[model samples]
Target: MDTFTELFGTSPLIWAILGAEAAFWILLFGGLAVRYLLRNRRLSTIMLIGVPVVDLLLLTFTAVDLAGGVEPNFSHLIATIYLGFTIAFGHSLITKTDAWFAHRFADGPAPAKKPKSGPAYVRAAWLEWRRVALAVGIAVVGLLAMQVMVGWAVPSSFAEANEDVIWSMALRLLLIAGIWLVAGPVYATVFKSTPATDTTQRVSPASDTLSNHR
Candidate 1:
C-alpha cells in the first residue's frame, strides 16, 4: 500500500492537501471577481448551489484517488478542514458575498423610507436566530460528513445516510444567517435614513446600487 506519503514524496499528502486548498481558494476569489464584474449578486447566489455540487464531485474523486493512491492522513483532520471550507465558502458565496460587496462598496445615499420595525421584523429575526445558530452546527456537520464519507470509501459501505440532505439544508440556513449577520449592520447603516443637512450629502452612486439590491 503506497501511503499518500510515498506517492507524493516525503511530505504526507501534501499534494492532495495543497491541491484541495488551491482549488478552493481559486474558486472563491474567482467567484468574487465574477460577481463584482457582473454587477449581479445572483451569480454568487448560485454559487451556493454550484460550489457544494462541485465539492461533492471533487470529494468523490479525491476519495477514489486517496484510496487508490493517497491517504487523507490516518487522522481525519484534513477532511474536516477541507470539507468545512467547501461548505463555508460555498455557503458564503451564496449568501454573504453580496453583503460583502454591499458593505465594501456602499458609498451612496438611500432613497427616503419611513422608519418602521413591524412584527414581521421581529418574526423574521426570531426565525433567523435559529438559522444563525446553525453556522457552527453546519460546519460541524460538514466535518462529520467528510469523516463519514471517508469511512464509507474505505469499507465501500456508502449509505445516503440522509446527512448530505441535512447538510444542504443546514448550510443554506447558516449562509442566510451569516449574510444577515454581517450584511445586516451594513444594511442598517447604508439604508437607514439620515437627517437632511443644510450642507446636504447627496446619495453616492454606489449607494443607489446597494439600495436597489435591498
Candidate 2:
C-alpha cells in the first residue's frame, strides 16, 4: 500500500486515472440501473465527469513513459490498453444514441412553454445541456489540454524534486479549479429554468422551495 501510494501520489495524472476508473464503474452500473430499475426508456443522464480526466491521464502517462523514463513494461501496456478502452467507453457514455433516444423521453416534467431561448440551454434550464453536443466537445478539449500539459511538464524517465513536485501539485489543483469554474458558468448559461409542467420544461424557484419543503 505504501509503495503504491508513493507511485501514485496526488499528481493530476493519477487523479485523472482514478477518476476515469471510477467513472467507468459509475457508468456501467448506471447503465444497468437504468435498464433494470430505471426501465431503459427513462431519460436520465449519468455524470461521469471523470471521463475527460482519465483520457488526459492516459495521454500524459504515455508521454512520460515514452520520453525515456522506465522502459515500458507489462503493467504499462495494461494501463495503455485500459486507458484506451476507457476513453472510447467514456465518450460513448457521454454521447450515445440509446441514452438520448430511448424511453420515449423518460418521465421528465415535460418541456414548459417558455418566453425566450438562447444558446439553446438557458432557453430551458429545466432541460439540461447534456442533449447538446458542444458540452462534450468542451470536455474533449479540456482533456487534450491536460494531456499535453502533463506530457510536456514531466518526462516519463524523469521524476521531479520535492519542490518541483509541490509546484506540480499546485498547478494541477489550479487547473481542476479553473475547469470547474468555467464549466459551471457555461452549463448555467446553457441550462436555464422555465416553468414546471409535464409539457413545460424548467427548474423553477417553486421546485426548489418544494424540494426544501420535502
Candidate 3:
C-alpha cells in the first residue's frame, strides 16, 4: 500500500484511472455472476449499468484534474486512451464475456470460437482492425479535447508544458494503430488460407485413396 501510494501519490488521475479499470472488471464479472448464478436479472442489470458509469467517473476525474492545473502527463494520456477503447469495445467485450459466463453457469450454448485461418479468419482480422481504427479515432479525439481544455483553462506556459507529452501520446497511438493494421488485416489478406488447401492438408493419404476408389 505504501509503495502504491508513493508511486501514484503525485498523480491522482492515474489512481482514479486504475480504480476505474478495476471497477469495470469487477462489475462485469459480478453482473454476469448474478445473472447466471443467482438468476437475478434486475440486480445484474444495475451492476452492468455501472460499467459505463465507471467510464463517466473517470472522464470527469480527468477533466477536473486537468482543469485544476494538473499538468498533463502519461497518466492523462492513458486515461483518455482507456476511455476511448472502452467506449469503442466495451459492449462487445461484455457480450462475449456474458456468453462465456452463461455457458459455464447457466448451461447456455458455448460461444463460437473465432476461425484461425481461411476466409473467416481474414474477415475476423479485418473486423478487428476496424475496431482498432475506431478506437484510435476516439482516442485521438479525446486527446484533442483534453488539449483544448488545458489550453483554455491554464496559462500558455502551463499548456505548453503538456504539448510534448500530448504529442508523444498521439505518436504512440498512431504507432500501435499502424502495427495492428499491418499485422492483422494486411497480413491476413497477404497470406489467406484457401478452403481447398486446408481440406487437402487435413486429409490423410489413406482417406484420399479410399475416396478416390469409391
State each model's CA lDDT, in order: 0.52, 0.47, 0.85
Query: TM-score, each model?
Result: 0.38, 0.29, 0.83
* Cα deviation of 78, candidate 3, in Å: 1.0
- Taking every candidate in turn, the Cα RMSD to the unseen true structure, in Å, is 13.8, 16.3, 4.6
Q: How close to the true structure is residue 25 of candidate 1, measured as C-alpha lDDT?
A: 56
Q: Model 2, 42: alpha-carbon shift in Å?
A: 19
Deviation from native of the Cα of residue 48 in model 1, angstroms: 6.5
Most accurate candidate by TM-score:
3
**Over the full model, what C-alpha lDDT does candidate 2 score relative to the true structure?**
0.47
Native-vs-model 1 lDDT? 0.52
Off by over 4 Å in 3: 1-9, 152-163, 196-214
Q: Candidate 1 residues 51-139, lDDT tens each? A: 56666665565456555644444223344445555564455444465465445555324433433344444444444444444545654
Sequence-dependent TM-score of model 1? 0.38
Model 1: clashing residue pairs?
108-204, 109-203, 109-204
Give lDDT tens digits, candidate 2, residues 104-192: 34543433343443544453342333323333334334334444544534434324522343233334434654565446435556454
| Poorest stretch of ten by lDDT in candidate 1 | 153-162
